[model samples]
Target: MIDFEIPADVAELRDRVRKFVDTEIVPYEKDSRVTAHGPTDELRRELIAKAKAAGLLSVQQRPEGMSHLEQAVIFEAAGWSTLGPVAMNCAAPDEGNMFLLSKVADADQAAEYLDPVVAGTTRSVFAMTEPDGAGSDPSQLSTTAVRDGGTFVINGRKWLITGAVGADTWIIMADVPGEGATLFLCHGDTPGIVIERVMNTMDRNYVEGHCVVRFEDLTLPESSVLGSVGQAFRYAQLRLAPARLTHCMRWLGAASRAQSIAIEHAKTRTSFGKPIGRHQGVGFLLAENEIALQQCRLMIWWACWHLDKGAKARHESSMVKAMVSEELFKVADRCVQVLGGIGISDETPVAAIFTDMRAFRLYDGPTEVHKYAISRQLLRDAAE
Candidate 1:
């Protein structure tokens, strides 16, 4: 039996995060300068300090005996704040990157890269998704990392990289000599490492800035290798499962906010004599959205709980990603519809939430890809 009840301490943490979001983040959403790429360097630093002061940073690294379900509740609460995830230093791809490094990095490696990240002293980017290929297919990775006398030289271009614009370091994916795939940690200033440009995404609240980066001949010491050589592909797969679930958790919060807005509008805005909410059409759509959100929440919690038990959660995670992405988008789209023209305007967050939900469908392995993966698993199970 699965227990979804969050413990008292975890519940308190969730309240703390929600309070921080209301006080610190909600006010800044309307600021013209805080675009989708997220807050500026100074703003991010300030927010990180504030979040740390509130004991919100690294909330995922629970005590030795804490449950994964507890962590998921806390994460979802942090997601409630528009900038809580990033502010608390628990947002992706950093969250996922940090988790992967902590699992595989040795003492020195952890000190140099992972520790600083957990401390929120620096930002990192995962150079995995490529342009024409390798987005969903790990085997299609085309970047190359050749071993030199005492270093590894990397050459390739990585696109749609979140936090690439101001990343202090990178966990780059590349093909290792004689190995199928590998991960290398390289500093941003390493020679031949170049950030081509920050891509303008629909959602502008992400920090560090998303960009397309080009590495001509970036060189790093052998110490840069993360985990066993050639096992990078396996590590990547491991990281994505939890990371995608986290996205669902956070986006679920955003969708809830949108729903709240729509509900408020429905109650106050009247048409033809009474509140539009009285109309069966608008009321039914709102009902469907509420149902979908609850269902998505349960799926995400299940996946997180499974992970806490040290289970692979391959099939479960894929299902949650596929289902949650679709459901969240529906909620966002309904919010836009309920609000009418005002919903599409920058006057409210509904428009931005809609755009974000669309992009969510693309990132962390698209819905189509997850469906294919889940279907193949079912077939294999049946055959067995």
Candidate 2:
């Protein structure tokens, strides 16, 4: 049986995270360096230092470890501010990569690659999506890694790779011809690897802007393989389900923040006569936002509970990701509408939250893809 109850330990951690975000991170939201394009490297380091001092810098798990459900609470609090997750060293590409490494990386690999990440000293990118190829579909992956004696030569163009700028490590997915898909770990500064460009995206809260990158005859030793060759999709699955749900958790916090700001505006700003929140039309939006937020949280907990029980949560996560991303976007959009012109203005983070939530629907597998996958699973199960 699934329990949605929050344990005492997890509740304490969530409070701690909320306090830290409110006290430490929110003040920096308006800093010039915390640009529309996200926090600059210098600002990132400063915030990370504070998080490190507070003992919240572990990227993957606490020393005591956390169930996925506990992680959901921590991640949500971290999402209170656009920078909170990064500050706590639990932001994506890195967070998901850390989870993947912990599951698959051998001892030496973990020491060399994962240690710096967990220490908040380095960031990594997942290079899987390609320009004309693997975006939502991995079977169309065009990147290739060909073995030659003891080393493999890789060539591919990858787009929409997060954290490519100044990232020191990478998890590259490529087709290995007869061996099927495979994963390669290589240094960002390795020869023949190039960052083509960082796309100027609508939401700039991503520390490293989404980027286009290329590998031109990049070579790696046999030891660079992340796990068993031909298991790239299997390894990726381990990261995808949990990572998808975590995105929901963090974004739920962001949407809730937007809702709270809107509520305050409605309470203080007078409409025709007195506070606008007195009007049913205006008040219903706030009411709906609350309902949606709670629903998203419940969906996240359900999926996370399955993961904590050592079950693959692929279908459950798909449902949560599609529903939460779309619903959270609604919550954010309603906040923008309720606040009027000021809400769309960058003067407040609500405008940015709306844009960020829109992108959330696209990444981690787009909404349509998840729905299709879920439907297929249901039909297949019924047939069985």
lDDT values, one for every candidate: 0.84, 0.89
lDDT of 1 by residue, 1-384 (tens): 756677788888778887888788777677655765766766777778988888777777644543557656767777765577878888877888987887888998888888888888888889987897777997888889998899888888889899876677689999986876999887777778788888887766578568898889888888898887898889998888888888888888889889999999999999999999999999998999999999998998888778977998989999999999999999999999999999999778889889878988887889999999999999999999
Clash totals, every prediction: 9, 0
Candidate that would win on lDDT: 2
Estimate, for each residue in 1-384, the C-alpha lDDT of model 2 and write its tens digit.
756678887788788889999999998888888765567778888999999888778634667777788888889999999889989888888889999999999999999888888888989888999999887899999999999999999999999898898988799999998999999998889998998888888777777678899999999999999998999999999999999998898899999899989999999999798899999998999999999999999999889888988999899999999999999999999999999999989778899899999988987999999999999999999999
Q: Which stretches of candidate 2 lie over 4 Å from their true place?
A: 1-4
Q: Which ten residues in a row have the lowest lDDT in candidate 1?
A: 62-71
- Give the true-structure RMSD of model 1: 1.5
